[model samples]
Target: MISLARKSILHEWRRFAPAIFAIAFSGILLVIQAALAVGIFSTVAVYIEKSDAELWVGFPGTPSIDQGRYIPNRVESFVRMHPDVARTEPFSWAGGVWRSRPGMGDVSVVLAGIDSRPGSLTFAHAVTPVLRARLAMPGAVLVDIADRDKLGVGIGSSAEINGRKVHVVGFTQGLRGMGSVNIISSLATARYLDPGLQSADEVAYYLVKLRPGADAAKVQQALSPKGSNIRYEAWTAKDFASRTTHYWLFESGMGTAFGLSSLIAVCVAIVITSQTLMAAVAASIREFATLRALGAPTSHLRGVVLQQALWVGVAGLVIAGILSALVLWLAKLAHIPIALSVPVTAGCAFLVLCVAVLSGIAALSQLSKADPAALLR
Candidate 1:
């Protein structure tokens, strides 16, 4: 029976080609969009994991580390007072522009400032020893590799930030924030670039590394009442990263764009599948009627239509998978955050099959009205 069904599908390839292509194109679009969204979220996760800090202490009501309020430098000292706290470091964040060339113009850049201490865990774990050494120097900055290429700036290059001289000392591979280029430098340098800048009394936040076997929640409670200007929250590195990912996926416009693209892909696939199956059924009405005239069961006719749908689905899935892979590779080359997970790709293929079956079933309604005598005419 399967062999015969295969023969039938082969016989109708000319009629099915356009439909197959349509479905495949739709699937490719959906997969690519999904991969891009997943990639962006994963980048944040990787950044936090690399930092290896146990807890992030930020301002109260701050939605994300990027938007957090400045904490008093005293907060860091206070947090360090806790026995469970192994080390505490102040982190500052700001945005500015760097000249594209000697006098070309200025392009946007994210400025992240951390304390110059070599023992700081956030710095120690996030950067190499050589880079850390370079960062310790005043006026030195680290630029993300992506920004380096985009801005055409190289290590040892000089750029002006808010009219203040800044020198690039090193480069970070994947340091980015909400789609902006990030430059890491000392807290004092960041303040120099923007003097209205508040010091530890107004530092962006504190990154705390806890002692081994210490409870983060207990440590957080112990440090909670130290200052009214600050609120302490404790999160495992993974949890904090997850929260950051969720913030972008759910709260940012990126989520909406991804969802709309996926919806359009699915809708396009459905329309193409439905129309193709309907046309196939209409053209085969005579064949279906002849079978009925020869005592073939309605169930048999249904099975044949369904098998055709399955064939279309399988072919489309293969094509779509290939196209998606090509797009993912291009994204990688372009350095865009786009990832294709095995489970996600597989799940999408399964969904395509289900959609095909449902579309075929809808087309089956035409089969119910076929009359042998009329088909013969």
Candidate 2:
């Protein structure tokens, strides 16, 4: 029976060709979107993890890094007073523009400033070692490698930030914040842009590093009362990173945008598959009727049609999977953040097959209602 199904599929390939192409194209879109969503979320998670802080101290009522207010520098010293708190580092969030040449156009970049303190939980040390070394120098900046082309700047290039000249010391790969290119510099540089900031006062947040086996919750509680105006939240390094990544995935529009695109692709697949399969059924109506007259069961005919759909779906999925991988590879080569896992790609293929099956079933409805005697008339 399976062999017969295969034969039927091959015989009717021409009728199903359009459906195959449509399904394949839809699969490509879905896979690409999924890969990007995963990549962006993973990148954020990794960034937070490498910081290696037990607690993320931010302003109250601001749930995320981007929305929080700068904490005062005094809080850093105050938190360090706790025996559980081994150390605290100041971090600042700022924005600036980068230009390739002295008088060229500028591209906007997100600025992350960290204190010069040794063992600081800084972007430079945590995310990229190369960036850490480069940023250690005074007045030097690190730009996201992906933005180099757009900014028209390279290593040893100068860019104007806040009307002050800053030199691009090096480049960091896979570093971005909410889709913006990230630029890392010292706390002094950040302060220069927005100056006279007190040590604890000018920081966006504090990263609290705890001693080994120390109770992070107890530390948080102890530090919380000391800074009555500020809120202290503590998590294990892993948990904190997970929450941060989830924040961007669900709260930010990236998750919604990707989900909507997937839904659109599935809908398109359904429409295209249904129309193409319908045409195939219509063209082969006489063949089906003759089979029924020749002792072929309705169930058998249904099976044949469904088998054709399944074959088309599988073929389309194979082609789409390969195409999606190629696109993701090209994106990576171009330094874009698009991560594709095998499980995610496989899941997408399964979804495509399900959609194709439904489309084929819809086509079977017309076959079910046909009357063999009517054609004889």
Candidate 3:
């Protein structure tokens, strides 16, 4: 039965080509779009995801970590006083200009102040002693590697941050969030860049390091907004990242746009796969009727149809996979950030199978109408 199905599809080269193309194109488009969307959102909130602390304390009514009001620096002291909280560090976020070179066009940047402690934002424990030592210099900051071209700076190179002369001490990976390239510097440099945060009453975020076995959700609840003159909102690290992701993915309508695109792709696959398979089977209506009139059981006919579906599914996946690779390679060459997770890959495979099976089922109705009388005619 599989051999017959294979021969059938091979015989109708033109019709099969269109069906396969539809499946391949839709699959490739959907997967790439989904991957890019995930990349953008994950890139946007990567800091919240990678922070060494378990909790984040920010001002109330803030939509995202980058847009939050500058809370007083003393909030770190208050948070540290919590028994479960072993330590609190200030994340001094400030807006600044990044000159590409000593004298060139400038771009906006988010400056985050980080300490050279155990939970340093040194790109996942790779911060070298020399880099930390250099960062401690009076006018040193780290830039994200992704922004190396954007900022046109490297270690030992000089650039202006908010008009303040500075040296790039090191680089971190994936720290450049969605909005702008990030310039991570020490607390001193952040204050130097933004004089408004010089007062003890102003800070951006408080990253809370809890004791071993501490309950993160409990700590978050404990720090919830209490209606104080200086309001505060607390979030667990995961929740904090989620909040940012939600804002960009849902509130910003990115998820909706991507989802709609995927839906349209699915629809295209179903329509083309169903119609083409139905027509292919129609071309053999008399042959199918003769088989039914002979000793071949109805189940055998069904198996042949399913086998045809399986052929389309497996071949379509191969074509889609190849096309997807081309798209990914081009994106990489262009320095476009696209991430394809295991789930997305698996989902694409599953969707391909669904396209095959669903089309097979829809064509089942057409196959049922194959008349044994046509064999005599």
Candidate 4:
């Protein structure tokens, strides 16, 4: 059956080309849509994801990192007191107006105050040691390379955050915020920029690093004991990152919007692909009738149709993978956040194959027109 299906597709390449193209294009849309949606929401957890901290201690019921409020600086002491803890650092956050220069409009920005000391765990993955060293300079700040134009500043350029002058010392990549631009600075700079965070006893959160071979979950439980008098909450790095992203993606309603758009794309793809396959099948009705007249069973012909659909799906998926890669590269060049995970790519390929199979089923109606009597006409 597969051999017959392959031969038929090869013999009628022109007839099936549209079906293949439709499947390929549809695959591209679905993959790209899923990538963009995931990438955008993943940014909501950038701080937690980009850091090497084993645990995060923050205000009770802090749904997400951005939503975190002041928790007592003593949270750091409590976290550090754990026997398995290696070190702890205070992570502060503030929102401020960025004034790049005269004539440039003010932009809303979120300031992340991180420990600039050597071996700091906060953003250790994204912010290099040199960048962290630069941040140690008072009033020096770092911004994502992608946001240079938006903030109207570059290295050596001076900007004002909440009317306090800040110098751009360096740039980092993949640190862009979901909505507002993200600015990285030392704790002192962030405090200076936002008067509200100047209270030395209060910080937004505390980052914890545990000794090698120590269990993070155990330490988290120790730091944030279960009791009615709990002052703060402790979260494993992985759990907090997931919570942060989940809050923005689902709790904030963005996931519903993205899901609807993706569903629409799938529907559009199914409709176009099914119509194309049906037409291709219809065009080959005479050949099918000839086979039927030669004692070929209808089930065999149906298998041939399904096999053809599978081949079309495979071909289209190959083309879509190539096209999606190109699109993702272009998006990167444009500074758009788009990422594709292995699972996501595999799921998308499965969906494309499912679409192809469904289209083949829809095209089965054309088989009814393959009557041997039609040959007499």
Candidate 5:
């Protein structure tokens, strides 16, 4: 049955091209939009996702990691007491005003205080060992390569954070923040830059690394202090990352915009795909009628049409994959944050197939024109 369908498509390639293109276009839109959406929201949790910490300890009721407040510095000692914990590191977050170049005014920036020790947990994925070594120098900071122009600074360029002089020692890739430029520096520098907010006795959060083979969830639960004296909360790394992404994605109302745009993409794809498939079916009505006249089952004819749709979908998906790859490559070169995880890519493929099947079902009504007597006309 599929071979017959393939033969039909191959024989009249021009007639089926539009339907295939429509499906491919739809697939590209869905996949690219999904990548952008995930990428944008993922920035909100970069601190969590890019780190090697197994658990995050922060103030109770912290809405998101970016909004973290100072929890007692003593919380580090409490977390370190856990048998599964290998180490705990203090992390600091505070808003700062970046003094840009002459024409550019002050820019809002986030001061990220991370340990510059050899194997710091924070930003372990994005920050290299060499950059960590540079950060160990006082008044040295790191900026995302993507944010250099926005903050009006480059490698070795001097700038001021909260009126304190600092120089960009290096640049990190894929460390851009959602709202503010991120200026990464050592823990002591962060405290020096924002002494009022980041004091010696307090830190915005604590990053916890567990011993090998320790279950993060179990350790997170065990470290979470119970009762009223609980001034802080502990979350497994995955859970904390999800929490931060969810806050920006759903709670912040951006998800609605993304959802609406995706719906529109699907609707457009379905409309165009169904119309093109209907036209193709209409063009082949006489062939269908001849098959029916030859005693072919109506069910068999329907199956052929459905199989054709499936083939179109497969072709379209392959094309879309190629196109999406090219687009992503270009986006990377342009320093755009767009990511496609395995699940997201798979979901898009499933959606494309569903659209193709639905278009085929809609085109099935055109089969009614396949009247045996129509051949006489």
Candidate 6:
């Protein structure tokens, strides 16, 4: 059967070539779009990902780090008292108008307030001591590298955040927000800048570090209060990361957009593949009819058609993988975070093969309608 399929592919290489390329292109599209979608989710939860805490305590109604509701600052002290909890710190989150430079009018910015303490964040990337020290200055804020243009600010440049003057003392990479800039400053600065700021006793969240050898689940159970009215919950870092991702991905329409784009790519592959295979079948209908008239078994006839499709699918996957790698390399050069992990790559290959098989089946259905007897006449 394998030999039969190989010969068939070789016989129709020209006709199959376009279909193979189309399927490969479609596979590449899926890989890129999926990587982008995952990247968006990763970016949306950058702070949570970077935090050194083992657990996060947020108001009950809050779905993620950025969507935090105001909670009493005293909660940090209370959380720190837990035997399993090693430390607790207050984080202040707010959105405000940013006026950082010329020609770049007011822009919405997400600001975070944290204590100028070491080991405060467990960044996927490293942070320097100098950058942390600079954040200790009054009215100092750290900005995203990309926001240099968006907020029109540079190192040592000043900006107005929530009507209070602030200096961009440093910058962090890969900290972009969804259509907003991120600025981190001291707790005092955040409170001074925002008129609607909560009392110092209140905070947007409590970052919790666990003791070594502590059971997170046990600690979470101990810390998580009962009753639906209680407005606080403890979430492990991974849970919090997933929660934040879910909020932006599904609740915020990012998931829908990416899903539709992927669906379109698959649909395109199927449509083009089906048409190409059907055309190949049509051109060879007489030959197939001749074989059938000679008493070729139905299984043999089906195997020949199925083999052609399977072979094309295998070829397409190879081409798609190469194309996807090149695209991913280009994305890295552009500094875009399009992941090409092993699982994602393998999944894409499987999906493209499925599409190819389905396309062959569609063409086979067309061939099934041909009158082998009439052709013999």
Please tell me which predicted candidate would have the highest TM-score against the true structure: 4
State each model's CA lDDT, in order.
Answer: 0.75, 0.75, 0.79, 0.89, 0.90, 0.80
Better of 1 and 5 by TM-score: 5
Best by lDDT: 5
lDDT measured at residue 307 in model 1 versus the true structure, 0 to 100? 81
Q: Please write out the lDDT profile of model 4 over residues 1-377, one tens digit for every residue.
A: 78999988888888888888988988999898899889998897989999988999998989999999998776777777788999888888989999988898999999999989888888989999999999988999999999998988879999899998989999999988888999999987888788886486678988888899999987887787687987899999999999988898889998888888878877887788889888888988999999999999999999999999999999999999999999999999988888889999999999999999998998899999999999999
What 10-residue stretch in candidate 2 is worst by lDDT?
226-235
| Ranking of predictions according to lDDT | 5, 4, 6, 3, 2, 1
RMSD score of candidate 4 (Å)? 1.3
User: Against the true structure, what is each candidate's TM-score?
Assistant: 0.88, 0.86, 0.85, 0.97, 0.94, 0.91
Q: Give the per-residue lDDT digits (tens) of candidate 6, residues 1-377.
A: 56866887797799889888888888888888878888867887778777787888989857877778888766776688788888787888888999876677798888888766666653424345677777778899998776677677788898898788899888887776766777888777888877776576677888888889998878987888888678688888888889888998898887998999899899999999989988988877787777777787666777777778888888988887787778878876665655556787678788889998998888887567555786847
- What TM-score does candidate 4 reach? 0.97
Model 1, span 1-377: residue lDDT tens:
45545677788788778768877887787788788788876665554566757777776655555666666666677678888888776778777877746656677776777766666656556677778778777789988775667777888998788778888888876565446677788877887776657553577767788889998777666666655644555555656777877887889778888898788778778877878888878887888888888898888888888888888888888998888888888877776867677898887888788777777777788897667887657
Pairs in clash, predicted candidate 6: 52-122, 73-201
- Evaluated against the true structure, the overall lDDT of model 3 is 0.79
Task: List model 3 lDDT by residue over 63-129, tens digit each.
Answer: 7777788776666767877899987777777888887565568899888777755446423344565
Cα lDDT over the full model 6: 0.80
Q: Model 3: which ten-residue window has the lowest total lDDT?
A: 118-127
Candidate 6 stretches with Cα past 4 Å from truth are 122-126, 293-295, 369-377
Q: lDDT tens string, model 5, 1-377?
A: 67889999999989889989989988999998999899989988989989999899999888789888898877888888888999988899988999956788999999999999988899999899999999989999999999987887778899888898999999999988887888899998998999577458699999999999999989988988789877999999899889988898889999889888988988888889889889999999999999999998889999999999999999999999999999989988888889889999999999999999999998999998899998887
